[model samples]
Target: MRKSSFMRISKSISLIIFLFVCNNLQAQNQSYSTNSKSDFWRNVQFGGGLGLGFGSGYTDISITPSAIYNFDQYFSLGLGAQYTYIKQKNNYASNLYGGSIIGLFNPINEIQLSVELEELRVNINLDGSNSNSQDFWNTGLFLGAGYRSGNVTIGARYNVLQDDSKNVYSDAFMPFVRVYF
Candidate 1:
């Protein structure tokens, strides 16, 4: 009789635990469903900031600001401007204009694939005594994917560039971070 009583108590406890777990899981599922019902890209957000670019034998610290317009749940456009300080003892600098297209896909939430193009005005001071500067134009294209959480975005990209006039300054891979408010 005692054994039978203990078994009854155990079964009751098991049933209670199962019901509690099921209730919690159902609540979680409902919350997720409600959030997923809204179109993710209806809101347009704009932001910009500073960054550092490090590459082979050169490191560039920069300020970059961007404006983004989200059209729907899948596609967006971004436009940005950047100024970079090239630390080559003589303070070589460049100003850049950037544009990009962002596409959002599933399997990874809040992640986007981006394609970008940049036009840069690069200046170099050939001599320390010369007040005059040599100016050149460079253009770049990039393909990458990004993950965003709240106001922060992080990504990796492969970049290609060419100086149209001189046929110089090739391409490289770069990683980046962006924030939006």
Candidate 2:
């Protein structure tokens, strides 16, 4: 009877030790996963760009002032406005105003995919030749992809709204560069 009692005590002690080891391993794995998720979203950022807008019968030099909001490492949204001088063959000059909303996706570290919806308008001088000046309005869309790293960004957009009344749409692939601050 004494030998049987001793064997039962040894089995109970071994079972307790095994349970303790398994619990510790599970806790360690859970902590590591939580830490990685925290590091992905702690960084916020901003930038500026300069490029050319060409379409129809008009080709203009433009400047883009931009800003961005980073919600996390995986996503961001941006806004930009562009201004340019429209130089025509008739020696008449006008001003162009444009705005855009940019969405960014981070698929890998130091790289991004950008999609944008851009709108533009041109102010024309109708009175320069007729003594009664008039203004012309033009609008269009641009869709493209971009790559970014550190403080520098570069991208190319395909012109989707290249057809307009004044032929003022940009029909070529537009490339741009940005500097983040």
Task: Please name the candidate that would achieve the greatest lDDT relative to the true structure.
Answer: 2
Sliding window of 10 residues with minimal summed lDDT for model 1: 98-107
Top candidate on TM-score is 2
TM-score of each: 0.56, 0.59
Clashing pairs in 2: 54-170, 55-169, 55-170, 126-134, 127-132, 127-133
TM accuracy, model 1: 0.56
lDDT of 2: 0.70
For each candidate in the order shown, give its overall lDDT on alpha carbons: 0.66, 0.70
- Model 2 per-residue lDDT tens digits across residues 32-145: 877766654344355666667677666678778877777777788888888878666555677778888887777775676777777777676642575644465555556666
RMSD of each: 14.3, 11.9
Clashes found in each candidate (C-alpha, N, C closer than 3 A): 0, 6
